[model samples]
Target: MMTVFDRRSLLRTASISGRAALAAPGLLRAQALDEIRIDWATYNPVSMLLRDKGWLEQEFQGDGTRITWLQSAGSNKALEFLNASAIDFGWTAGSAALVARVNGNPVKAIHSFSRPEWTALVTRADTDIGTVADLKGKSVAVTRGTDPHVFLIRALADAGLTERDLTPVLL
Candidate 1:
């Protein structure tokens, strides 16, 4: 017989596995966890669903653990929260997470819930910015330390340009 797992079940399984991995070392020390802070980002629908369903709360109720749900406005915010130890788990873009890890944040990626194609370079229809090169002297609004920023940087590099060639308005 074959069994199919829905989105909820998949998220639950991943969450449980991640939690187990994190708690294993602490388990040897007999550490008691009183609270778990996790962030939900708008870009991650699955996280929103998990938060709305209160699955973490239900799972830890027997252990008297409190599940605190936090909102991450962007990958940059998520990384900040992780660095500050404000949250135990957070949803962030792979690139953003990698950047944090490279910067010695001691973060780990437990699960990849989705491969998103959400980043884009857009310009006003009235503007003459037709290509990456056209953005050389333009002002680009970007959230630093996020996936979009990485994408923009790569795009600029590909065009033989850099942020120095453009005005990057940090959002």
Candidate 2:
């Protein structure tokens, strides 16, 4: 799926307790840093693709480098890891990148991932509710700062509705 990557803080947790500043395979190989720790957002396909596939480890296995993976529930958690220096790379959205920058996080974008929009709203099939227009004066649940919220905004705009039309339920 092609995904729009929103800006976000690097999801790397180099915490005192607990970080994919993600690099393409080519770049990763070229740098060959002493250690290769990739911080992936919670449980997602990218980590599965790399860890389950073993592609990243094998490439650096003989180069005296070790591969480590950090799992984060969300970009905010991932950014916590980055601040601690526990990881070298983090995975996050473009919106996250923007917020983190405003709050003072040092990071850079080195690659792009899915071009597809990864978030959407789903209602029960038998429900009378249908489109955003059906939501007038109703409540909508959304993740406050994430794409779910972004989707709600864009979707409402398409329906010629505004936040005034529906009460927001933040999750």
Candidate 3:
């Protein structure tokens, strides 16, 4: 004779399985928590704040996770770190992020950390070049393949011109 399982027994099994399913992702995350390396840049004051406070370290310490702070000289350095998998997270200018994506860097911009007006286009005081329009037909020194380059492009566009209109002296 076959023994029949009661409703309570089936309900108990289902409850236990449900509990295990609920706990699985947390356990997986705990196992995955080996280390996290994030960019630290004086340019990014929020990054400095996070690193100086040691908040991230404290939070992940109990899970045996290591936290590393790497200095980013600029958005270029941050992109390099992210591209090479040297860092899990890095801070970079929005334009740099766009460039990285366009070039198939396989990265994502996860945070809008700050709006600090960190960059500007300037000319020598003695120069007659006072505005974006003045840039036309002029030679401008720029680090090619960077945020400044993108900024220059935008400036040129705003002035109803393009790179073809200027002599871009790549540095």
TM match of model 2 to true structure: 0.67
Best by TM-score: 1
Q: Compared with the true structure, what per-residue lDDT tens digits does model 2 show for residues 27-127? A: 44455567777786644555555566565666666766777988878766666687788777777766666677777887665555545546767777987
lDDT of each: 0.80, 0.64, 0.73
Q: Can you write out model 1's per-residue Cα lDDT over 1-171, one digit (the tens) per residue? A: 323447668557756765775666644335667888889988777678778877777777887778898898988788889889999888888878888888888887767655555678998899999999999888999977777898899999999999999998989
TM-score-superior candidate, 1 or 3: 1
Q: Order the candidates by TM-score, highest first.
A: 1, 3, 2
Stretches of candidate 3 off by over 4 Å are 1-32, 113-118, 143-147
List the candidate numbers ranked by lDDT, top first: 1, 3, 2
lDDT of 3 by residue, 108-156 (tens): 6544533435458898999999899998889988866776788788888
Best candidate, lDDT: 1
Backbone N/Cα/C clashes per model: 0, 31, 0
